[model samples]
Target chain A: MANPLEATVLVLGEQSEIFLGLLKKHFSTIYQLAHIENKEEFLKDNGAEIIAVATSNNVGMSKEMIDALPKLQIIASFGVGYDSIDVDYAKQRGIQVTNTPNVLNDCVADTAMMLTYAVARQLIQANTYVKKGQWTSSFPLTTSLSKKVCGILGMGNIGEAIAKRAEAAGMEIIYHNRTQKNHVDYQYIATLEELAKQADFLILALPSTGETQHIINANILDKMKPSAYLINIARGSVVDEKALVESLKNRQIAGAGLDVFETEPCTESPLFEMENVVLTPHYASGTHETRLAMAELVCENLIHFFNKEPLVTPL
Target chain B: MANPLEATVLVLGEQSEIFLGLLKKHFSTIYQLAHIENKEEFLKDNGAEIIAVATSNNVGMSKEMIDALPKLQIIASFGVGYDSIDVDYAKQRGIQVTNTPNVLNDCVADTAMMLTYAVARQLIQANTYVKKGQWTSSFPLTTSLSKKVCGILGMGNIGEAIAKRAEAAGMEIIYHNRTQKNHVDYQYIATLEELAKQADFLILALPSTGETQHIINANILDKMKPSAYLINIARGSVVDEKALVESLKNRQIAGAGLDVFETEPCTESPLFEMENVVLTPHYASGTHETRLAMAELVCENLIHFFNKEPLVTPL
Candidate 1:
């Protein structure tokens, strides 16, 4: 007794619990690829019926998977980053792609600010010191973050948010971007190496692309001040992870505050061994409120696409 | 024959190594009170010659010690807070009391902001989770600090600095002060209880006074929203420790970010076991730059007092 107009959407990998319920509430048919006993048989049977794919950037679209879905018309991604998606391939196939954006800016900014302050204040080490009963003597003095020059690499929404917070905390802001963003007064550096050298705290909020790959490489790191710290809330591909580990080891940079890793879940790395750096499991926009907002946006984007309206945030 | 201008200053307790060096550099003669192997014998012989006393709040000027130093003209305290000093008794005896202030505001404000963000994002637990290799799974979503209402309890220089920083981070400003100040844009809450009720984060930046002691008591804590947090950087006596412990245990308030405690060298406490609060060993201004500035101020205060000039920061 299913409606003939009800098209099945293949969910690639496990979606969030919130998203599952929401997806069911809005869509009549659901096909979770991970739960299928035999993917080849299930796809062979239901491939023609599948008109859309709902997935996160974590469980991305692949070329072979795309070929399996003969009737697939759209891909709705949960996260803002679309680096994992083969956009060119999707475009050639005329597969429309949509992503959730802007809804998670506040929480993502909070995360960036959190990491910046956490690394600078040595909160991780200080907290451990207090809990381990080692506060018997006076705690050692750490460097001050106030009044330092906060150099933002990408002057996007998240970077502007970080700058606003850093400014409130008495830090001066300078940045390096592709082109001068109009209607903003923050100083801009011409090159990445110069920006790295001058920044007291260098933060990356750039999107990932082929040209932007390994942007924070050995040369840029070598140019950075020994006292400087780096914060990455953007994609992991932006940084040269091997070079970063070496710089952190040699104290070429004072420390790092990272949310994304070159490879996640960074189960094993030299970063895990260092006390100077803070590692987060790529959850910068991981708050319940932001996630809910993002999930809602994803659902809405899918709905809007099916209704043949302009997408809320087209990728 | 002793030179009147070259005052013999009594150094009480174990002073900071930096302060000890600075003290000796500015003053011609120094007497180490703690190191005087025979205290009574030494006092009997040299007490009358002690023209000034240099001590921290920890080694406060006891009434008996003040009586012993008959020639003491000034008390140069190393830290800003003069709560430990018997200021009235010193005033009665025509003795000057000077403390270092303003020099520590930037660092203190930094500490307050650090705690606010640390508690909001659960930085302490996050750090521990990553270090213990438990980040194989995603970290749970914590609260966002951006756009929250930051209600400052005291609007002094340190509080103002905190406001400026919090404002830049997109937090709305509100405050509860004894009286309304001129030329400030933040909304004023008339009563402390109401302020606590409205705040997402209630920060204590007021000085410790007889009236201000236990200002954040059980009754005031009862008025706070369940989602709100308390940040104490002012002094421990400002909050009722028992009430705070109970509130934290019951989740009456979300959490606390504490840098000051009711007692120094806190060997034991139930708070040590709680994961919701972040604690520091009362080192809000514990940065090299700020400490050095404070030390220099202490030396300058002593030098000014001996030179018969007006006390720089008289208590």
Candidate 2:
């Protein structure tokens, strides 16, 4: 059913089946390049025909990959974070870049709150103890997360969402970011270290950026109270993994709840052996409903680009 | 080392070390009956001089135990729920009863909200997969908890606290209680079954009583949406463990988060092996700060009773 008039779309990496099915309806040729075993050769064979690049945040556009597809007109990514995509290079080439935003704020903020409670309550350890029949002999008390100060690292849309949730749970809200957020009534601490000092739980929710890199390293970790917890739902690049491991190992801080890691597929880490840490794969916004919405938005961005309509959410 | 004028208090069961330390400061003749090898012989040996009985909710005053303590003046319990204590028998014997309340509402409600998120997101399963390195291959998306109806089984203080937290997490609040709550705007579903049918999460926070025992039995569980979650932070006896097990096993309901069990020190149960259930071994109110506050209140009640002053929280 090649329409011949419709443009070609080159899916740069892994895309959900639902997204592919929807994209196929709009475009004449939708070649998922990842499905091909020889993707490098496949891209070279089809590079001349690829008018657009379809990918997710994880498989972001790079200079070399974009250079291969000289005819690339647009890049539609499937997440809020366009840090992975080479947006500057695409803009220089007169290519339009779009992303799915505002849609994932709810689920990601839910995860941040979930992690905050999970770590503070020692939930995973408590579950393990009950499963192992240790409660029959002894049970230890955990710290209460309610009525404590929750320091958010970023005061973006997601951070505001988390604050609303935390405040409703009876926790005081404080935040540290590059600049103060207007409209929010929460207390603002200028420095990350000061925010760490005031909080019982320090939650990281900032985007991955050069300026924000290692924002929570040893210096900031040391400033945190020994009774406090660390929760990261944002990118792992914001935290110094080695420093966090050392701090957790030495009991410099209480514990952590991590959904992302410094490296993907974190097969080996000292954190895995620690009882205090609650770890999850990079799936903070990975909800059945939210992911489908994001996938649809990804398709919509591309379709709008082809239809000469204004992009729904252009980066 | 002993205050001769102080009342002789009989310690009924094993107490926490922190609670014991605080109790020892006020009372002179604190005879810990649990330390005795033969409790029957010990009661017979030294039951006459016991002016007051100091115990927790688990080793509550029974009719038989009350009959033995002919000189008992007051019973100071260490937890909010005095369901285990024979209040009627105590009243008949003119023995005053006091319990710790209000101090644990925040932590207990936090547990309710935590359980809600844990079960809905399949948090425990997600953590296991990431820890086991299965994330390297694949990870499935979880269900979103936001924008769902959270049905609180009882609109008591703890349930209200849970409502506030759930609302902050972007959930609609529905409630089923004996009567409608005043000063709140949340929807009220008259029947428990109706509430269960409308809810995405049904959290149990009702006090355990003769009227409430097995309140969430088969019929109510069956009325619930198959995709909904059950969160029990109240007494475990309210839920029929056997019926819940059956529903979960057959996938009649999606999942459950249980903080208490019918028989604690539950050494054996099919629940321990279930993937969809998150068990926490009666640790809902197990927070260091809250327990300390509860412990302090227990001591204060005894002190007030001995001083011929009014009890702080009399039942």
Candidate 3:
């Protein structure tokens, strides 16, 4: 006598053990896999009916994998970014794709502000100095946010949140989004170049797509003030890594605080060698509270689907 | 004729070279005789009428130096911690004492939130593993901050600000202050012990004073939830460093995020050896914009005093 709730769940992305454990609680016979390069192996062995894919910009699922899953009814993503899972492809197969959105807004926003603070105050560098016993007399006097301009690119939920925190710190807020948001207090600009030229601190919060690729390149970097700082908590591909490295090297920009990079598990990036850059391994929505909420949301979405209920925060 | 503005200023404490350059812009004579173990040697060489002292808990100004400065009319301390400076002595001598107060409030609050996010998500530890080239495979599992109580000690300006940010993150706010503040919308507790026992995360935002010393001791730690975390961005002396080290060591507490310590240049502290604690050199308000504003405030105070006007933030 098999349980009526038994569903074969395929988890494609890595999650916190807590989250993974929670997923197992909801769905029976759960199979976990990270970057399933061999699609044939997954299809032949697991017999997955419902796939829950955890997507990041670094690791994405291929189009071929979707076609092979005969019993796949839903492609549940753990996060807002479905750039990993081909939405159009999944839609064509009568497969419903869902993502957890609006849950990570504050966490991502907090991370943006944290990166900005980390770079402006030299927290990471100072900690490193203290750890390395490099205290000759004192640490170099770092910058403050009392009179700085915080330029936010992509005036979405995360950008707005970062602006709120930065504004509370007495920073003048200016933003450059694709379209001007209505009834906003922040000064909006049409072009990234115009925003870069004006801002002392530029934050990239735009989603990554074809139009956004290499958005922050040599031409844009040239427009930025010499003392300006760049922070990217968004997708890594939105920035030109080589131009950023060159700008930091030539002192064209004061520094950069990067959470994401062109590659994940960044082992040998030139940006790491530069002291001006604070490199984090793309952990914008990384918080205990936020992650749990995200996991619960994923679980709720799966539960609703199984019970024939409407999706909450559908992609 | 000598320029009337050519003033000799006695500088105290450690300053960033950039900030020093800013100070030099206003005053002609900058006497940087920091760490003057020999009071007589410092006073004899620098015949300055105004002294700017910046002292932390470790390196404070001695009573002897204050007596030696016969012509000193103003003693402008570097930071808000005028506890190191004998304000009463200066007041008795009809000397004005000014400290940088409101300028640094926002930055400190920002750092508090930064530590809160970093610890909650295990960003520092996760990043450390990735940086050390230990990422053999993807490991997923992180703590979430949803539906948790954040107990704050000392609901001052910074604490209130942290509360606003925490509330935005959907955390339940409980606080213990000397007296309840009317402006904030948070649950108030009469004592820290009550707050500590209930909170999933206990944050120390109280000042370091005689009455508040070692307030978060072993007894208090014993009462706190075993899964709870402790964060201190306030003065280090407010929490018992030894008790905290043992709490984390014995797994009595989940983790700690500390910016300040019982001692500065805290190289030999046992907390550093543990993986459960996230330690940063006392740099809650170490942002460049904030530092410059503080420096400007100091310069303005000196200007106002010399002109026979009231000080901006006089003690």
Candidate 4:
């Protein structure tokens, strides 16, 4: 067992202060990668002493970085998605990997439902209409979610949570997963094309992997009804941004509510100008409550690993 | 019985073409008040022949207007709320009154839930942040609706519908109505003050009437938790707008989601400047599906009354 007083932890990139504070309280020696200048020199001096690498989904552990830290035992990630991390390399190196998952499912699901309503009802445009003093005339009527088909692309924990809310709002839920699960009652479409064709709102909730990358490309977008809306709370890699832009321009689909983009910190895109789309800064699970809970989970996973107990949420 | 071909129907103001067409199909002598140049001359020429008044909640038939048409036997309103119409006088003269209710409950409730999530999640500001190229910096974390208290002011059809959606989002429901409802399983509070103090989201879902006017005034506003949000999808008369603006300015309440204003077509207000508040033009039931359904209900009520059947939804 690694002693809490001696085992060093290296935190990569930016994280919430609460997470940093929790690490500080538990470990005696902590190094933040962001604060370290001249990374080569610093790692040469201190890398071998580091036992755990704390990171976020955005600042994932690369194979090169993993090779640099010779004594690294674990990689504790701060988000549910670990696609950015080279998980295969970590597994080959016999290093434990953990992520904060179930803690954030509700908030992420809430975001998916929020975007569904926001796009379907044109809430952002409605707010703009009122703020710009355009209430003298009636705003154009938008579509309603009730009795509409909500086709989910993934049926994981987050997808199920979203389905519950959509069902409560009088929306019918249908989904297309890699394979159908036995627990849920929602009808499963075997093909993604059929799901897109039948959906009034096509929501992407699957993980981003090599097989899933750019899955919702031109072919799938073409299959969707012109009135259908696309909602993506999943990773940005699942969509082809250029194709989505063209789809919106051509009115191939009604609109989109996107939290993630193909290239983020995506400050400039044609989507910014479109009135039909609602864009957020990749903010699914970006709530104080959920983030804090996630931070706590990340810290707990690290604490459990150091204590030689079973990892709370290990990959 | 009034002959469908001979009985005159006076449509008070501008309505959808679908409504006008529906009326035209059943009645040959249709007079649109907006098309008539001189109301006095038009009333003198055709008022006695008018056996029914077709109007909307916004352009309601007043006591004087009801008196103008001596033969008026029914006033079929196009919305659920008949507060603007002089119902007492209509009843005194044995004139039946009907409104399109139940049909709009789902859409209006969807609006309430959308605003609740929008306000709590800071969705509009987040969109603006991303659009303005501010995603380079992190958008601030916002509150989550899950595990929070949702205090509803009225437990009517719309309120119940909102409650169902809120509950599905992992929120606990507590409500304050004139009297406790019989069928609901949610906790009922006896006083509005307790509900305000306990709620993380205080939703106003009651109607606007003599007793309900200005119910959410400065006193109730002050009672709300500073972290709480106000969602008004009900009539604006139910809330004291001046007090609400003051509360928002002072941050007495975190923010508000307003679908209606005290005096609407409210082009000017202090709320337009507040980032925390989300303003939507009185659009709770403003979806194409619900509007058309309401219009159809209006026509059906008129048809049922003309045929000497019971009204579908009477005030």
Best by DockQ: 4
- Candidate 1 vs candidate 3: the TM-score winner is 1
Give the poorly placed runs of model 2, Cα more than 4 Å off: A1-8, A25-28, A36-50, B1-5, B36-49
* Stretches of model 1 off by over 4 angstroms after superposition: A1-9, B1-9, B40-51
Question: Candidate 4: where are CA atoms >4 Å away?
Answer: A1-6, B1-7
lDDT of 4: 0.91
Q: How high is the TM-score of chain A in model 1?
A: 0.96
lDDT of 1 by residue, B35-86 (tens): 9899999998998888788988767888788889898899989887878888
Encode model 1's per-residue lDDT on A75-132: one tens digit a residue: 9999988888887788789999998888777777777877887787788788778877
- Every model's DockQ, to 2 decimals? 0.58, 0.66, 0.38, 0.84
Q: Model 2 shows how many backbone clashes?
A: 0
The CAPRI classification for model 4 reads as high
What is residue A129's positional error in candidate 2, in angstroms? Answer: 1.9
Pairs that collide, model 4: none
Q: Give lDDT tens digits, candidate 2, residues A1-315.
A: 435337788887777766777778767887887778998888778787787778988889898888888888899998888788888999999889989887888888888888888888888988888877778765778888767999999999999999998988778999988899889999999988899999899999899998888988999999999988999989989999999999999999999999889998788888888888999888888888888889889878887888889999998
Question: Which CAPRI quality tier does the interface of model 3 achieve?
Answer: acceptable
Candidate 3 chain B worst ten-residue window by lDDT: B50-59
lDDT of 3 at B16: 64
Where is the poorest 10-residue window by lDDT in model 4 chain A? A1-10
Write the candidate numbers in order of decreasing TM-score. 4, 2, 1, 3
